[model samples]
Target: MKTVILRSQALQGATASDLSAAVQYLIGVDGGGTGTRVRLSDRDGVLLGQGESGPSALGQGAEQAWRHIQQAVQAAAAQAGLGELDLSRCAIGLGLSGTGVEAQVEAFSALQPGYALVALDNDGFTTLLGAHGGEPGAVVAAGTGTIGEGLRRNGERAYISGWGWVCGDEGSGAWLGLKAMRHAQQALDGRAEAGALARAVWAVAGQDRATILAWCAAAGQHGYASLAPLVFDHAPNDPVAAGFVADAVSELERLAHALDPQAELPLALCGSIALRLSSEFSGTIRARCVSPRGDSAEGALHLVRSALQR
Candidate 1:
């Protein structure tokens, strides 16, 4: 019996023609801390189906993540008119949040799914691939959590922020919400000036200190992000919200600037809040921003095809 060395041997050495003949389907997954989506296509890249499910981000339980992915795959197959989908005939590509962490990456690599082959990478890379259509450019992902990613013509890659909800991910939904909560707390204590945004946060998070504190203990990134919309809605008339937006824009600028220090490369603003925040960019980033060519799922598929062809 031979012991399989997956760490060194996975996703290596398969000819294009060989894989093309052996593989009947391709599945691309875009997974984040909040949700997971799956897109299915045939060997030739014609779209077949798509599906979405719960969160599959890293650090979450591996079984939970795989389970949601499996469910999403099944949903896609059903939408593709297949009553019975065989995983062994399908190849998969996944771009997942938190996979940048070495331990998280290693944990996922150890898994043996029934797919013919699998390619896994951090979600930001796929975001960059999708935004730029595989070209050399950068993307500032402003969503539940923010991150900046880029690829140079020479294949040099860079990532900034995305340190998660607590300390980093500046200008992200969670960041805004966290700031809003802080303002709300301060308002209650009379320690800082409160405005319409802070008042709104108080209404949503409960009016009392004890109640707000309890909610904070139970709240996660999503909960924090849910408050961002309120802040955005009130930003026009609310000084506090306006301040939050200003800070967020500056942080995003920092992220984009780090990738293209000279602010020369084409940049795309992506994720849930990209368009909303785009108008706030103060520097060259505003002009450098380009529309995304596709999305993360498409990039995942593209990566799969690229790998197979290699």
Candidate 2:
């Protein structure tokens, strides 16, 4: 995977002495099915650099997540002019997808790369932290997968959905792609009309029954999610695409309702797919929508900061 490094101006004018004397560096990671994004900072929470790498979702495998995380962290360190980063001097925070699975969480946590400090939480919870700045609110994040997280005013926490792409994660990119695949299959089998959406799926997966079958057999969650854009691109003119999007919207609303039944909490719609469908929500839900104060990577930084205080 290609690694991209970026510089940050958060502490542009600060001198070396301005950095924390204890921790040399702070790293915040947002790892999901599509990619891993990292933020490098000084202990004062001043951004130093940023980096990105391929998928690091725990569902993909702990080893895979670790490899991508290391790559991204190295890239970030390089951008910050910290050559050959010393993990032992850094405090790290991770907001990773697939934390819903206990086995996956344990496996991923076991592979920590010897940081001076480490804090980990599911991407959803971290998103909630970032969205409301750890205040009382909720967030529904949808990209390669979907999850709902909320921190109530009563200091209570709520989690909903996010069952992964295999059987759940409704309204996710993978879910939409799966629905589109089913439409294509029905069209090919003469159970439904071959529409623009079906033709588009054929172009990517296969043009015939046998090829399509072979493609499905080899496809994983990420592979299926790769087709979500096609579904969106054709939504304006394809009934099937529009139908899938409608279902996705409904699913998102359900998640919102489940998270805050009274619809009283400030809600943030996050990730590519969720943001794309934000305006489609009903009046009540839309009214509750608020822009996130920060992204998940920033929230991960909060994680490490909290860990340090403890």
The TM-scores, one per candidate, come to: 0.91, 0.91
Candidate 2 residue runs with Cα over 4 Å from true position: 1-22
Give the alpha-carbon lDDT of every model. 0.81, 0.86
lDDT at position 296, candidate 2: 94
Q: Candidate 2 at residue 206, lDDT?
A: 94
Number of clashes recorded per candidate: 0, 0
Off by over 4 Å in 1: 1-17
Give the CA lDDT, 0 to 100, for residue 203 in model 2: 95
Candidate achieving the largest lDDT: 2
Report residue 262 deviation for candidate 2 (angstroms). 1.3
Q: Residue 52 error for model 2, in Å?
A: 0.5
